[model samples]
Structures are given as structure tokens and as C-alpha cells.
Target: MINKIDKLKDPLVQEARELSSSKKRIFKNKIQLRGLEQLMWAKYAGLKIESIFISEDQNVDDYSGFSSPTYQTSNGILKKITETNYLIPCVGVAEATPNNDDFDDFVLLLDDVKDHGNIGTIIRTGKAYGINDFITTNDDFDPYIPKTIDASRGTAFKVNFKRYKTPQSAVAFLKEKGYQIVATSPYGKSLQSTVELDKKPIALVIGNESVGVCNEVLEAADHIVQIPMHTGVESLNVGVATGISIYELRLKEVLTMLAEKIISSLGRKVSVTSKLIRRAFDIKLKEISEFSGDQIIFLMVLKRKSQMNEEQIGEQFGYFGDRLEKFISPLYENKLIKKEYEEIEITNAGEDLLAKLWPIHEKTENILLEGLTAEERKNLKSYLEKIQQNCIKIMKYEV
Candidate 1:
């Protein structure tokens, strides 16, 4: 952001640049905490503290029992240090790195997810669900985005993340080290059947919201499962879906892990169905955002009606899926059209959710296929595939 040469006081980035080197051990540990809110939040959030910065005008007496090196800087000096044109009286810098787990149990893989809020929410969910140690693509959003940072409730500081230039590299690292890679796809096998939950040590890769996972990334995954839908809603918001998926997957993994342990150590498989159900409820929250699946169905139908119908919608259920009820109940509850209904309409909510459904559905079907059950999903699949083939043909034809 401070790209202009003149805008920078130490335009060379000498401090950050110098700190970039592993030497300067003392300086690396010397984190300067500035601003009242930063200090308060950092303190409350249990982040490590080395020192604090305060402006002369602020009420010093407000903070009790907190003492550190206090430096008096001119308004210009404070502005110069953080290297921002916009001035803030305070900020916090902590010389702390969050602990990274190896994720011997379960972890979340970020494949070039470049949105700041999305990354932060992903991290927050990872932490919430007892997942740590991210193996993410090099181009993924910075975990330290101010919006991400705030959205994460400071949990970002507590997460351990390593970046890889390609998702393949990360997958290789995890696989060679022995971890199952689960990729999420709307068109993939149903979640319930695809994942046994009884499997131990898995990594779930959440891709870009718009394009989903790249083909290379998808090929790298061990299994793919979709968040099943009823009516016509195609996908869930990346953050919301990521939270639900991680929560469901990890908890199930944990229980299955414990079951495996009990089976091994105690020579018995312990049943935790009740506990699993409760955990699933708490995590797979009903945040549909749309009024009904029909709302979503109406949109997808409006988008691809010539290609799909209700019979195809039924086949998706025949596929093993998770959280399908969460998405479908409302549509069924409201009796909205699912590509088969005659009267069709798209509400404001439907339009909004539809914008997030990217890379289209037929592409989804061809990418992840099972034998066509009743010809409805098949018809939709065929329609979509033909359209895509025609588009490719035309593009090549144009050339």
C-alpha cells in the first residue's frame, strides 16, 4: 500500500527488510504494542506482549498495573513508524507466533483462496473446530489482513500456517507424511458416503469461492463430497460452508479417531451416535440465507432450466450427502419449484445467492459423475455438458 517512494519515511523498508533476516534475534522478539484498543484487545485476547506505545494526549491513568517502555513520539513520528498516511494514535505489535499443529487428526487446506475475510473466517472455524496448522497455497489471502484479523477475533495470531507455491506441493507434503486429502465439490460424491468419518487424519481443502478448486488441486484430493441441496440452491457461502464442513468433518473425525483408539486399545468400538448428532447440530448451523431451497432452485432453474428437472434433483438425494436437510427442508417446507414447477420467479435473496455459484453446474456434473439414476440429473448433466462443448467448439471455431 505504501508503494510510493516519497510516502515512505524509511523508503528502503530497512526495518522490516532487516527483520526479514533470521538474525537480529533480539529485534525480532522486540514487538512494539501501540494504541489503546490494540493493547486492550491484545491483552484480553491473551496475545503475548513485549511493550506498549502511547500518545501524549491519551489518558495514561486508564490502564492500571500495566507498565512497559513508554516512548513519547511527535504525531509525525508515530505516523512515520507504522508507515501509514492515515494516522492512528495506537497499535499493538506482539513478538509471538502461534503454535502450529501437525494436524495428525484433521486440518483445513486453503487452495489459493485469496479473499481476506474468507481466509480469516476459515481460520476462525479451523480453530473453533480444534483444527490448526494450515497448509495453504502461496497465493492465498494474507492471514494478517486487518479485516481478516478483526473478523478472526485475534485467533489468526494463534494459528500456524505455511505457504506452498502450488496446492500440489502442499498435498505432496501432507500425503507423503500420511494424511487423507478431502476436497469439497458440489458435483462430487455425497459427503456421507465419500467420507467414512471413521477415517483418521484427514485434510479438507476449501477452494476459491467463485471458481472452486482448480483441476490440479481436485486431482490431488483423495475424495470429493458435495454439500447436498434441495430445490435449486447450488452452493453455500464459502465461509459459512467451510465452517459447517470443518465442524462436521473434524468432530466426526475426532469421534471416529477415539473409536479407532478404543477399538485398538480397548478391543471395542465405542458408539457415539448421540454425541455426534449433538455436535453436528451445533456446528452445521442452519444459516441458509435464502428463504427456501425453492428460492435457490428457482434461481438455478432460471439459470439452467433447459438442462435440469425435479427427477435429477431427486438423484442428488440418492447420493450420500451431508447437510442436505439444512438446505432442502426450507424448499420442501415452502413447496417452491425445483426446475419442474411451471410458475418461476427469482427473489432478491435468490439472485444474491446465485451470484456466488460460479464455474456453472454442468461443468460440475461432468467433473464429478456417478451413473445417472432417473435421467433427470442426467438430462441436466447432458444439457450442461452439451452447452459447454458447444461453447468450446465455438471458441475454437472463432479461432
Candidate 2:
């Protein structure tokens, strides 16, 4: 015999063997490794290895390539294990539990996903997408099974996984923590197009292989989103679907966060609304006439005042002399403005252009208040007036 069989009966070996069984184990503080790959993964995850057992033919020096210390080995039952089609050359023991509270921002909820392969792939893919927290319904399938561990490539050791008695329990927990529950289904709005995920701290629930997300869980969700599919393909493997959804949703969240950061940083140095107004005015002006924002302001002012001398317009807008004239020249060339000497007036064409431009301005305003209620709009207007008052006070050097 190339290896000893009595060593497999060691307490640690028995623990590893028992862990491989189908029994449900909670709060797993110890993980059993079956191969060098899993041991390497455990090392990478910073897990403290309690012990290592390798086949007699394998050299400890070869396995000691990792950061972990070399260990004494025995040819235990591992060498004589004929039950499994493939012999596992090594088995490792290490820490496996993660704090439930450590998961933040985004979480993945698996609903009755019975297949170990699917669960493993989901964890592996979710980790790639920045999802560290995984919750599964109380099902018989063990996420730490050798098959799952093998498929996850040991990513299971890195994930903060928790099991709930039911999907409803998971949803309730997330909801209580202020997470927006987004459920995946084949029948809902397109995942790519849905803006529901604009809300932060998302808890994405993916359902079982055959029946999809449970009805109770779906009913509890704040939004139902689905991936658009081609004809004849009724559904996707839960693992594949979860991976796709996580990629799309997590990327959106990251992009949204980056945009918010950029906006905040820019807000300290420049006016966001002012930039938007200038850009939107330019775009709207392009559609109507060859007028810049300054010229449009002058046109609207002239329209309001019915006509004004260049000096008077300059006094009102603080734009005078050659600069004022230069600004008006483009408008005049477009037939939107007519100037005789110092007096300037808006022509019929200018009036029509301004009329068309009013809708664009309205559209922009509507866009800003897309989801706001009437009361919110009223409050916003009041708030803007207060801001104006504060600005005036600052200009006057008032405290």
C-alpha cells in the first residue's frame, strides 16, 4: 500500500468525513478541504488551517508551496477510499463562518436552489460581481458540499453565507434593514431597462430551477425584474440567470455611485443646475434658431419688455456696448431680432422661435420633477426661494 489507512480514523479526518455528508450544519466554524485546489483557496481567503492530510505518495514539500506551515501526514482511509470514483489526494480543515452583519450595500438571496452545482456557480459568479453576502432558504442542499466547493473553486469559503427558514424570512430581514427587495422572474419588466434598482442597498432574490421565485417571495418584493430572452427559450438555469442579473444590477449600482461621487465633487466647485441649464438652452437653441444662451436671454428679455434701447438692455442685464451688440448680431442675422440704432426688438420669427423654445424649457422642468409629487414641487419652489434670499443676503454682506 502506498499510504496508511489507520490515519483516516483521526478525529480531524472523521470531522472532515462527517462534514462531507448530507446533514445540515449551522454556524460552521470549521471547513473541510478535499483537494489541493481547495486548500490553496482556503489559504488565499486567509483562513487559518487547523491541519492538512495528504496521500503518502504526495510530498509535503510540494504542497508546502503555500504560505501555510508544513504538517505531518498519514496515509489514512483517504488512500483506501474506493467509494468515490475519484480519489481525493488531500483533505484540509479551516475556519468557515462569516459574520452576517458584514454583508452590506448589496446581497444575493437564493430561493430553494437545490442543485449544489448551481449554488456553487452562483457564489463564484456573485463574488466576481462584488456580491459578498449570500442567503439561501432552508433547503437540504449544502452549500459547503464537496461538489459545491469544487464547483465554486473554493469561493464558498470567502462568501458571507446565511441560511433562512424561508424566503419570506430573508425578505423580511432585508426589508427591516431598509434594503429594496428586487425579485427576478421570467414575467416581469426587463432587467436591463428597469429603473427600480436606482434605489440603493438592493437585495436581489433569485428563485429555484424549475418553478422560479416562490409566490410568497415574489409577492413580498418591492420590484419584479426579468432578463429579456429570445423566443422558444422559456427560462435559464438559475445560476446563469443570477449571474446575468448580478452583473447588470451591480454594474448599475457601481456606475450610479461613481456618478454621485463625481456630481458631489463637482458641486463643491461649480453649479450643476447652471451647467445643465446652459447645455439644455444650447441644445434647444440649436433646434429653434442660431442663438446662444446670452442671445436667447436677450430675446426673452426684449419680448417681455416689448423693445428696449441697447443702453437700457445693457443696464438691465449688465451687458452693454460692443459685447451686447456682438451677442445680438447672431440673433439679428437669424431674423429673430431686429435692431435699429440702440433700440432692439424681437421679430415675428423670434417670437415663434421663443414659442417653440418654451416647450423645451417645460420638458426640462418636467424631467427634473419626473417623480415628484405636487407637494414636493411646492416645497422645492419654496426651498429655491429661500436659497435666493440667502444669496442676496450674502451679496449684501448680511450675516
Q: Which candidate should be chosen as best, given lDDT against the real structure?
A: 2
Per-model C-alpha lDDT, please? Answer: 0.60, 0.75
C-alpha root-mean-square deviation, each candidate: 23.4, 16.1
Q: What does candidate 1's lDDT look like per residue over 1-399, in tens digits?
A: 011222223523234223222233233532333356556656666666654444455555665435444443345545665555766565445554643445546778888787788888888888887776777877333565456666776777676776677777888888887788888897787663346743647888888888998788788877787787677887888889888788677666767687566766622321353344334333322343434333344456655654344345445333124554454556545543232364334444445556754333333334334465657676866876886698679889684
Task: Highest TM-score: give the candidate number.
Answer: 2
Which residue pairs overlap in candidate 2's backbone? 4-75, 8-76
Give the range of the ten consecutive residues with the poorest summed lDDT in model 2. 74-83
Clashing pairs in 1: 34-91, 35-90, 35-91, 190-320, 232-297, 293-331, 312-376, 312-377
- Candidate 2 lDDT tens digits, 1-399: 122345656675566565555562344556667788888888888888876667766776767566444344544466333136566778766767555766678998888888889889998998988789987777454677778888898888888977788777878888888888888887776565565465568888878888888999889888888789899998888888888888888877777677666767844434777667667767766775566666667778889988798778776666777887686777777888787776778899999887877777677668767899999999988987887787778889855
TM-score of each: 0.55, 0.60
